[model samples]
Target: MSSTPGLSTTKQFRNLLLSDQLEFICEAHNGLSAKIVQEAGFKGIWASGLSISAQFGVRDNNEASWTQVLETLEFMSDATTIPILLDGDTGYGNFNNMQRLVRKLEQRKIAAVCIEDKLFPKTNSFIKGDAQPMADMHEFCGKIKAGKDAQSDPNFSIIARVESFICGWGLAEALRRAEAYRQAGADGILIHSALAVPDEILAFKQEWGNRCPVVIVPTKYYATPTDVFRQHNFSIVIWANHLLRSSVTAMQKTARTLKEQEHLLSIEDKVAPVSEIFRLQNAAELQEAEDRYLPRGAEDTCAIVLAASRGSELGELTEHQPKTMVKIQGTPILTHIADAYNAVGIKDIVVVRGYKKETVNLPNLTYVDNDEYAETGELASLLKALQSRKGRAQHTIVSYGDVLFNKYIPQSLCQESDDCVIFIDSNWREQSRYSRLGGFAECSIPNSRRAFNAKVYLKQLGNKIPESNTHGVWMGFLKVSPAAATLITTIITELLAQPGNRKATIPQLLQELLKRQQPIRVLYTVGHWLDINNLEDVVQAGEF
Candidate 1:
């Protein structure tokens, strides 16, 4: 018989019991921990209520609420494809609550839930000792029946957790309650005990025989061998609360060590690295989502604008705002550049601001502050922004804060085939003097009168290009594909490690890529472009 995808986990879980081999279920508190359990070769997950509540620093007395547990289970369900058996404490209330909980769990693709026959707002068994009261057998059985009736998937389990052992009511009462729950439509029975040995569990399992599958959480009796569990005919074994406990211990040790030494060097090797955390968070999937759902004009592309410089040339404008914050016509120059990208649906914009950062505000844009702006150069600001986006963006555009150009230039750069595209104006030498006043664009091209101020394409600075080989002047804009961006970022990282190169310019970094024989594509455009250096250029920008 062919099976549908819906409730496939529930079906798999039911089959696990029928196979006669014990299923090992590990407890997980969050999605990341759930992935760890699956990667460790566990067959299924047991979403322990104690672990879930402790994750939020709350007590395990239903203080975290059923909704909170359901939310955590949803994350576990999304993080792994294995079956998740949730711990439903006292059915979260009564028969009506049990019905809702069953429906929600089934909807979330949970395989099963073990609801104990105890009073509502149940405390952890190991904590309250023998004082915990057990619920009436007939009424608790009705809760199981309601849960079973509400589940649309026949394989979705409602396992009855008997509290008789915890209440010191002995094996006879436990067997009787388990049988009653089985008659009321519980698919399995979870006989719990807080004893340090497995004798009570073994006796219950032996007397119960194969009447139904027996599930046990060997927390207190963790030293018992798997062979012992198998010999007792236990169908499933849960290692509950261990993962969260270990995490707490490791974290506390790290925190205490840091407090004593006041540094991270002592505990660096003992903890997991940030890269591993990134992998656990599935950052690559987030980038893919950005590529899929974000506006496709640039297709997973982003841009970083180096706007930290104060633009000392623009005298009065320097008094209040950063260079990019200077107004061109009625709007800020930064706003103009952002609008150009946003016009073509390029929404992932990161602007590095330093001088008067609070004054350069724009909606729907990310900002990173260059705290060392006064002592460092533009590359330092770029590094700050790029650091925030490492391994998160592939195709990116790097632009200067002072340049204003036709929006079509960026659109054209996006469709190129090469790893990097340098926007240049080949006609800069022939243009009138007013245009040159903006600043002479520079490249490695030697003896080129048009190459003067080295503002853009810093990655191409040190190479000496014959005037004849030079096609145009750098236009303060670049489109870097994934491969070239990675290389450029790597070179920048290496340079920043050197004491003298920490404040290296963008053009200097581009020159490193050029020296390494990285192919640099040039996009020659004669469209109206303005590089605002002084007040005259800002006026020219406003006029043009």
Candidate 2:
């Protein structure tokens, strides 16, 4: 995507190499780093061999296989629009290996490769600068020719890295190797050095005299000014390994601080927020793609929140506002639930309001009034919402307004394909404090230690289920398919026909569905939800 409209990535990279002005590139070892490099306004990427090897926890001695390095290059290529020049150490083998490497690089859309004239399993230049031996000149030239012939793209480049200076063979051998590689069809030359100054590079440039484009990696001589490279007319300067090194320093500090403090309080402001990570990962793009390509049913799922009851157990908290309006961390409980629903693409929300109805207003919600609030329970409110909507949604979510849960709960529930699916908190035993709050469930498989993917059906669900018979507690959230929505409307209409059943609850309605063999499935989660029942619950919700 970053490539010029008409030019290919290989051409873009070749242009940088042959440009009249000095060009700069930064190193990136992974997809994320490659994106970061692109974000920082770099024109190209130097996929550093040392950095890539270090990322895999291996020494930069070809310890990571060629295929493994190619896999990383694929990700980097996909993540950014810029050309990548890979540090292909010794072409990973001989002339045949060089040929294969070039074809694979083209497949991954890599722009160029810079292979050192050193033996296979080459040591890092800085590791022991003078100890490593250079490859035979004729054989290395043949490898360069093989790579050049193998490339399918005309602009795909091969920059021969001369190691004569690194091997203490000095400037004469470096120029000789450079000339031979250029004659063998190398697109450019990368004259490598590990000296603390640019004396050798400057001498090589002066004598080489515009024979071809030249590249320099000034890692050791970083203190030298950038203007020097520009003044000397070098083709490109690579700031290799700094990004990886800087990340290492930052991660080390963050890890040590976290281990010592045991909390994120001190370091929260010092690091990138989770939202920043989402932005860098281009999460919004995926959402847009889903909107364009996914089914309408997935996007059109509706939510009906039952918030009609006055939570008397909260004492004075519900005296002025409904329990769902109680603020936790400055956001109302109902707002949190609404946000969760919207996050999972459930935009058409209907809130059934009753107690302190005038105080229950929120943005972007259709309100259905349950005027007989004092005379009824959750079932009556649900009935009001359903009758108002007239069974329009293909899939509908029913939830209690006072419950606060992680967004993943609703995200997971939306993926269920069953006609009726009930969410049960299997960690109910650990959450004994909520046992008295009701909606205990009894499933066909009573044991909580079943296989993770085991199919379990709800046999009974109500406040009256005995503790010994209940497998878990319902989190007051359920999804209903179109058929189940129709079935529920019929059942609720029949039940509410009797005036005395006006005070019925949602759990009781679920019990009736089970008795009629409605085949409701259970979706079990551990603990990631809470309900506000009493004043103690208010305190816990704040912390939740």
The per-model lDDT (C-alpha) reads 0.81, 0.89
**Once superposed on the true structure, which residue ranges of model 2 sit more than 4 Å away at CA?**
297-302, 305-371, 374-544
Residue 423 CA displacement from its true place in model 1, Å: 9.6
| Tens-place lDDT digits, model 2, residues 1-544 | 3456677789999999989999999999999999999989888999999999999999999999999999999999999999999999999999999999999999999999999999988999998879999999999999999999999999999999999999999999999999999999999999988999999999999999899999999999888999999988899999999999999999999999999999999999999999999998899999888868765344757889999888888878788998889888888889999998888778889999999999999999999999999988777888888888774756888988888888787777677778888888877777656643457888888645673668889987766778788788888888898788888988988898898898877777788888898899898888889877787777888778
* Candidate 2 whole-model C-alpha lDDT, 0 to 1: 0.89
Q: Which residue pairs show backbone clashes in model 2?
A: none
- Model 1, 492-524: lDDT tens per residue? 788888889766787676667677887676655
Give the worst 10-residue stretch by lDDT in candidate 1.
432-441
Question: Distance (Å) between predicted and true CA of 513, model 1?
Answer: 23
- Report clash pairs, candidate 1: 458-506, 458-507, 458-508, 458-510, 459-509, 459-510, 459-511, 460-510, 460-511
Candidate 2 — worst ten consecutive residues by lDDT sum?
Answer: 429-438
